[model samples]
Target chain A: MDRSKLHSVIALDMVEFEFNGTPHKSPPQTTVAGLLESLGIEYRFCAVEVNEEILPKAQYSIYEVKPGDRIEVVTLVGGG
Target chain B: MSTNIHRLSVAGKLLESRVIVGTGKYETLDVMRESLDASGTSCVTVAVRREKLYDRDGKNLLDYIDLKRYTLLPNTAGCFNAKDAVRVARMGREILSDLGNPGADWVKLEVLGDTKTLLPDPVATLEACQRLVEDGFKVLCYTSDCPIMAVRLKSAGAASVMPAASPIGSGQGILNPNNLKIILEYLKSDDPDYPVIIDAGVGTASDVAEVFELGADGVLLNTAIAHARDPIMMASAVRNSAIAGRQAYLAGRIPKRLYAMASSPEEGVITSRPW
Candidate 1:
């Protein structure tokens, strides 16, 4: 596996967070959860939507992520 | 039933159907899809949460539904105050705008003050609704069974006021019909065009029908239909029940009676009990 090629810009919609830039040509078959785990960022109370498609938390293990994907991760916060 | 026809208009768009469904709690995507199709609902509500778009892997639930079919109503589902609701509403607008869906201004404003009952914080909800409306967002406020609050919401420019039949996911079914009826009557008297939807606490199709019969413009249900053994079938039943109830109301129901109706002929004098 080429570590240098695994760099590609990952975008986080949350203002408080940032995806350390895109992951390059790593494996195209990376799971969403695997990618997040690699980044050392664990989202406890959030839901992810890729390219306007909502990904259920349960399917993160099987779902694959690709380059040039606009990802949105929304977290729950307190307020009335 | 008055000969005058009733129409429900939200954000200047007229909807012939009055049943609104929530896209949550289905065991499977197929069941959800089938349920929505059966519900005949033009609008379906969704909640927004924070998560990474592209994680270590693949596609998400957002792709499951055909956005072209049903109207997407983003709700401030977990927000507990007006400020949070405003923030989420802004995020919702941005998400929609970025997606090239300008119609995202329509929001189901929900501000739960308590976690136990998931009750609507009427005061905060109204505040949020007022601000959203002022910001050009078409607000549909989920409130409690308070006529005064409902009236205030209507007056504050809410596109619609959804008074809860009971707490969220409680399946209580119009805990206070008298209060809801009063709210309906007030809306009719003040602004006959105001749309009043009974949101939450609806256990079954009959519950939905009862609300519609009580003169609500529509009903918003999620758990009842989604959690059913046969969600799709229940959705169909709820849809039909809502329509039937609305039609029954339009058809004018007989006034309630204080006593039982006499089964025998009063004047004909039938000699039946010759003991």
Candidate 2:
């Protein structure tokens, strides 16, 4: 979502970052848990990477994602 | 003979069924699940993709097939290079851990040659297999009916070496049986139990039967079942065909002859023939 145009950075305290190779913005949903929730990503279905390091599931809610962090998420899908 | 239940063993692990279905091309998740049930498979193949930002509502694929009930053979389906495949395999393993199922660390490695043929690139596949195996992942590599590559993969500690019967999703069915046969014969001879699975190009029940007869340890297919007019029925047929072929292989067929020999006793048939 293009939330960048919605408000100034200081107003909503939102952070913009790269997710799955695309630009994504959230309300500073700082931690991996909050970022995943804000992205509506099923926590159990995927592996998350913040800034090139694989963030363990146990620390998803603890490891904070910040601006300029390149996050990658992946999951298994239906295909041959 | 006792029905002791023949098992298809791959890298010391015994499979419950000879047919492995893929979780793709099904009209619905229910159809896919039902077809897997009908096929009597204990495992299913899946593709790994980047997660998207959306509140998925409908039943996910995981909802249809429980991970504990089935072995999820995740594949690096769209990967064209070793780097991508390695990255995908790492992510797949991490996903497994994230799901609290760290034991299910199997990945079906496939590095494609092109979009049209959908054949595996030998260089990339072997490289990926070696890397993944070293990284402690059970690699079931998907390659063409290239016997040398199969051996290399087995040497690289791949859990199983899967060679395509034909092009992916082509439904052509064993386009080159000789190559596949050579693969089965070669791999099994090395360890007397090395699993050589055939994936792709299975069009019908007879294809499954023929490949099994050729000594394929197992079959992995998706388009053949999911695209069938009756996916459930096709799944049933494939299950029976696999068993039948396995039995035929075990029972041993008569050797080929130049001409047919009379089955009836010659003395009993001679007098009547003259009259």
**Which candidate leads in DockQ?**
2
Q: Where is model 2 more than 4 Å wrong at Cα?
A: A1-6, A9-13, B1-5, B98-103, B270-275
**Against the true structure, whose lDDT is highest?**
2
Candidate 2 lDDT at B67 equals 76
Q: Which residue pairs show backbone clashes in model 2?
A: none
- Give the TM-score of each candidate: 0.74, 0.91
Error in Å for residue B123 of model 1: 2.8
lDDT of 1 by residue, A1-80 (tens): 35544432222321222232333333456777876676554544344666556666677788777656656656422111
| Cα lDDT of model 2 by residue, A1-80, tens digit | 36776555455586778888988776655788987776677877788877767788889988877788899988777887
- Tens digits of per-residue lDDT for model 1, B62-110: 4555667666678899899998898777666655543444247888899
Per-residue lDDT of candidate 2, residues B108-129 (tens digit): 8999989999899999888889
CA lDDT of B226 in candidate 1? Answer: 89
Model 1 residue B75 CA deviation in Å: 0.2
